[model samples]
Target: MPTNVSNLPPVRRWVPAPVTKEDIDWADLTFVDLAKAKTPEGRAEQVRLARDATHRQGFFYVINHGLDKAIVDRMIDIAALAFDDVSEEEKIRYRARIKETGEYLGYKLPQYWHIANGVKDRIEHYNFPRDVSRREHPNVLRPFLPEVQRIVEFTHRGVLNEVQKLLSLGLELPENTLPDLHPFDETNHSFWRFMLYNPRSQEEEDKTDNVWMKGHADHTSFTAIWSQPVTALQIKDWDGQWRYVRHVENALVVNCGDTTEYLSGGYYKSAVHRVIKPPSDQDGYRRLGLYYFHYMADDVRIAPLLDSPVVQREGVNKFIVGVPPVQETWRKNRASTYGVTQLERAEDGTEYEVVNGVRVTHYN
Candidate 1:
């Protein structure tokens, strides 16, 4: 008989779950309530939880964070309708044109990304940039799930702001420390993504290893994912073991990214995670996900937090330095990672590759 997850211990809170390796213990991920974070004590406690989670696990579930079930459900419904209802030709009408020019602020059809194992990721997605200026782009103005775009845009900004507050609190810096870098101005580099992963047949699932997405980190400062009832999402624990991440009703999953890890001088970590085939029942149906990638403005420089005590003790030598602006990094990273060949080389000819597009590397 297959395992029934619902009968297990509290799925919302941290509880014991069997792991693949005998030496690996189940991770103790926390669920922080943002509503209570209104008070100083509540905020402090939440910050403590966040601090510990980032330092150790780099991912956690959040509750009472302002996004309601209606919003999440509507987003999901709209995403499904867009991908399932809209004809492929219609979607292609808005298909990303800027990728050729080294921009990723539009629609991407399935199979645009390939796994290291030569398997193409079966996903279709539409990306919306937070920068108001990009609103005039043909892809943005084109009618490909307009309502879905609106709701996601509204929800993502609010969530990023709140998460930034929590991050600042956890870092022991002024609440605006991170927010100051991420403004919703015309130069915004943030983006919201609506994604649908096509389902696999039982025969296909059985023959495959089921690693639909390779483990990687987000390149932005923060990433927020709405919880869906799928069991494919897995995160690497401190012990280097991969375990399924549980979905709690009405909770959003948040994870740190490479930019944040750099900013914090390694005090916080960027999680390594991936998606595989879910359990038997879910494997038969399409999986939909909503994601928000938060970033500083194009002009904001990437640098370590000089005032952070954590950085002071750890020493700046261990952290990244002299990084370019956010947009520069974003363009170069996206182009290199996705094989968008247009802007692969800088004018001066430094060879760079975006390892997973979230991590950066350069070679002479």
Candidate 2:
């Protein structure tokens, strides 16, 4: 049986050691300025930063990025408008539906979402993907204001382009690591936008419940997040300390994803994180954030970093080395929340079940 939210242990608080100037490894940091990354030295530095930060903290902040401030503001404006303009009935129109077997659309509730059993996430989010063609089995028509739709498409393509450039640099691959054409087959690539809201209400604030996201790691290649003034994101340091990641205007938070860990052969870390519900009016304010998840193409093989043979050998002994040939691990991770059949639908619209740890997909 799943554990009750209230029964979960309280989050332990630990003071973090202050980050000093000397401790700051400039080599491991990626500033948002791409022009700076254009020169040979600049490109070298960017790759170093990407590799080091992923191996060390699995997260970093980017400033001076090319994303337009105007576009970002407009996106946030649309989010607020959606919350305000869409009637409760209209919002419910997009609520996911289950097919004949009675599985609600994909992962929904915090308590029931894919992940290990834990308390529900305190955050509420709106999900949107970049490209939707009829060819895609899971593609469903979603309601969006015309202006919002335009912005979503523009931002999605622009951000993806930038991400591809960064990936190419870090991987030392050809400029078209992710070609103009889709890198992964339609079945593999995953991209989505998540508009998260952290609202404060008396009922929510006063509840003595542990209804918040528990510590977990993402299942993708990387996540790019941009936020407005509200601050609710925090990172757990290696020393078991929680550091509040203050949202600087126009900055993007970049973090490593599960695929990156696999590709790096475990050289880069896929850090665990959680969302904490802000205290009600803790200084007379609430928080809001927008997150973009960049997933690896489904079929991309993940392998450990080539340089660290010793650690790779150790990892093999520990059963953490080498890329698993199939998506069994990924499927198993989501099964608890999405159920075998529902996860299959979301992945490829086929009925799949794991019998004896083998995923058997049934196609009509």
Candidate 3:
């Protein structure tokens, strides 16, 4: 039977009091302005801030890490055009399919009562995989129009670069986890673009009793989100209080994923989050967002960070670095033993599937 939203955990009645510029945690979550990571001391401070925030709140707001604002605006504009101007027929063409080989692009809707029953998410999105060459999968390059195309490409590249920097700071490995190349290359990692539309009509808003995304953690190592100035985004704080993450101009919200949680051996947390249906007044405008899910190279093994005292306290031992050779063994054993999975869903609603025991998820 389909799950109804009403039966899910009661929408926490407590919404965070509005956040102002003054409330922003500059020391822990704001953007860094330097051309590169700071000196040893600065680097340590940044890492400490990120680690503490992840361990406690599982979410943080980022600024000044060097993403181009023009690019962000262009991407947001293109996303609006794709959803607003493109014909429904054209958008449907990019829908994902689930086959014996694996899941591919197509549109999916939530089944009634699905969330409460542990059914898959009921949302529609466009899936573009970064692992497959654009030539091999031309659909990956398809956008509703030419301008949209340019914006998507640029946004993909820009965000990937930022992701590399984040990974470098979080991981203490000598070699860089993100390879040098065009930001959105499919050869080295997986990248995807997801455009979401939540309902706005009065009928839809009233149906919130049976609708909205359920609580869940992302499966990738980390995710970068550019949310439209809408009201649906919410995060669970350390105190188990639900706080609304209102959209801030030119800011990207970063959160750890399940993979990061496992590799950090619980030193960092994969934040629990969900989407709620907006109130009637705000529903008319569709919610727009672009997410870049970052992954380690195909062979990266997720052992705890050795230098951190937290890992020692958690009993995580040092292990060889690089992707595990037996991907299936690693996935099953990791999830069962450590309680997390590597494969995850992008904002685009595309599932990153393992192929032939290889971790084929995007690393951007």
Candidate 4:
């Protein structure tokens, strides 16, 4: 941490630019109240709500998470400066080596990634791993690392831990061992992301039907996306229709990750979602996003807790034959993908691949 953080720029909270004026179709999502989740009686209420959320949509809104809005504002404020005030060359120095080493730490440049069918990908994001000291970041991020660390820890312990418990209780578990399975302070793939999606040209949009990202699922225990006012995010529903995920003020949109689906024995399969060009009304301005990508521990296996009554009730134990650690699975997928050499979908447009001896599926 910087000495006293005195040299850091004064906090100038970021004000949201005007939201889209377009009348867009939005999906109805269940909201899990964290304030209620903290209480004994309310915990059960949240468990049911969360179960309903994970079961169908694999997505939901998390509200009253007790993460002070001001702190969030500060984080975004600092992130804005980090992106806007620095040189691309300097930022690129810390870019993640996802292709080379299967690592997603530090900065990732816009348009650096390749997309299929001649579509140009546009994004610049920074990923700060759970262990902040694991890699160096841009100089501008140094002073705020302490507070950023606090925000990460708080989101894990205060916000995510509550939701994890709800999911755990929903499974009829005797104890909330989910915390032990996904510890906050451990060496995990969990990371905070500050991202920017720049506007695309009309010609580019025409080529891809305004699709900014292809269908994909995250390799995390759970993913927390700090809601931003841009109608670009959409999820593939059960009927295979694309539905927009609405933006809720002060709510973190949470989704079940692939790893969690494996752990739950398909009780809640990971949802597939993607980004598209901002609606015409919102396309004029760039979209800035804040997120906490929560991955399982390095050594957590991809298998259900058979002891759980729900898993047993689900059916005959037909999970991974020889389960592998999630870290290896994540590493294989990360290293293989990212425009180097397209790994043909295992079958019928799927991200099914055998990694670490487990059959993992994440559509891409």
Candidate 5:
């Protein structure tokens, strides 16, 4: 959930190690062709690629996902209209009050956010829930609601479902294993976001030491971003180096998140990533992005699904079941990031835990 309010507490500045030729070790990320994945002839290779991508980089590109071109185009067109044509007043008319719904839906105007570099990010976003029928308030852009809703539903039913099934196969679990955790029949709390990063003048960019967004891991299972020509997204490498994620035509970039990492018994990683100015050639353009975040129902308790082959061999990590509901974790992460003061952290203390032999954030 996002708001126009500012309340982020002080944190350390983000100064990544300088980029060097040797530090830049990898060439390109693993790309999976969904069309190939669905074919009997290519299924085995597809699964192998999926397994390597998830376990090694925790991020990959998907092509031939079977989304109708018209739907994809419409989604992008509507996003541009929302950001460019719609007035600020119009956006405010539909702004979501998180305090009221206890959920992250609605317009989130740009606000100051201290990143690892200790500079506020210059970005704004509009978040729409996956199920339009469950929306508590009407969107001001009502005229386009039909198309918008269709796109969200299509992404979920078309792309998300297939990716989940493919990953399940790669994990050696039942085809429905991951999908069962996220049933379409339920009121899924997943959301689609339309975001814009305002272009910065050279002087303005020079004045700040921060990147567009501080490096952080998504808290969902996996995040999907529509490929756009503008390139500004970056992902941290296994060796703690930052590298650009090149944009691929008609491909959706997918990255594992915290929940997936936990559910996979730490076999998969929650890739740390951030946005920054595109390479010099693309710097003049304002960056527009579309993202779909997929997650299990809020009430579902998340932990290692103990029966997975990886868990069976290596055992479960620190995140045990029945600690807190998925929604609680979602709320806590959002509240902490946005400076929302209404909710306080539960008295339960934090814990230092190891995953893949490295310490990471964990709470019991």
Candidate 6:
């Protein structure tokens, strides 16, 4: 049974992933099994694997991280309930003040952003920053905050921290090198999000070519997406071709984000990903996503770790002076993502906006 069972609404039919299509070529992403890191040899091997995953694909799957299955199911169930049980009129009361404050700590309606040709995104989500209690939620999710918090805490400590350390070791830096910059005790934009991608009509789907979200990188550091069976998630491969991320029960599809590119001096590039409509076997089902976004401390400098042997050898690719702090970058990028301010598109056909000398990309 999931957590907060007594308070949960009647369980809805949980949709599972369909049989993976045989003709589709899935990305051969590296797998980092957390349970394998119990021994020194095991940890060393994981470090190599982590480096490979970061260096090339920039996205990988993590398994055996010890997050209980029931807890994950509870979070998923609560996501569906939070979005469906609340009325649109009432949901706005708790919406994030993105245009005003650039903080992503509440519900977001799908009708806010224009995807392409004025077709708004077909997704709704609730963001719970590390200090989730800062924002008010609807009654449907009020009782499940603690359960959701568990997901955030575990993802931060049990997952992100370990992965950070492993990557730092791969850089030949101290084990705590990267993790120290992202202290959970302090506040940052790191958030746990419950996302629901609503199904689109055939006309709308055809108009947009079935892309739910556009192909772009994340603005934060690391993102851990709890893998559901849905086959809509895809990542741009090394050859710049999009490939579906294979589904693994109870695994997390973790990826690097932009801030990490600056911190590691470009040793790790941010993963570019997008969501599209599911295959024929899984079409018309609402896609549920649980994500933990990790960001560095706001006061931390967004520069290369020169102490890293790999970085020193490779040289810093993004060591510009007068770089803005993490807060401004996070806020500006967050605020501009949906064009809270004026937005522009490049002649080259990519949606782009600049903030603090950074080019933020969006889908058309």
Best by TM-score: 6
Kindly report which residue pairs in candidate 1 clash with one another: none
Point out the worst 10-residue segment of candidate 5 by lDDT: 9-18
Give the per-residue lDDT of model 1 (tens digit) for 315-346.
66334434444545654455445532222445
| Shift of residue 313 alpha carbon in model 3, Å | 3.5
Q: Write the per-residue lDDT of candidate 2 for residues 141-194, one digit (tens) a residue.
A: 233333334544443455444555665455555545543322433543344444
| lDDT over C-alpha atoms for residue 311 of model 4 | 74
TM-scores for candidates 1 onward, in order: 0.79, 0.65, 0.65, 0.90, 0.80, 0.92
**What C-alpha lDDT, on a 0 to 100 scale, does residue 239 get in candidate 3?**
69
Clashes of each: 0, 6, 25, 0, 4, 0
- Candidate models: Cα lDDT each: 0.66, 0.47, 0.50, 0.75, 0.67, 0.81
Give the local distance difference test score of model 5.
Answer: 0.67
Candidate with maximal lDDT = 6
RMSD of each: 8.8, 12.5, 11.6, 3.2, 9.6, 2.5
Clashing pairs in 6: none
Question: Cα lDDT of model 4 overall?
Answer: 0.75
Candidate 5 positional error at 159, Å? 1.3
Model 5 reaches what TM-score against the true structure?
A: 0.80
What 10-residue stretch in candidate 3 is worst by lDDT? 8-17
**How does candidate 2 score on lDDT?**
0.47
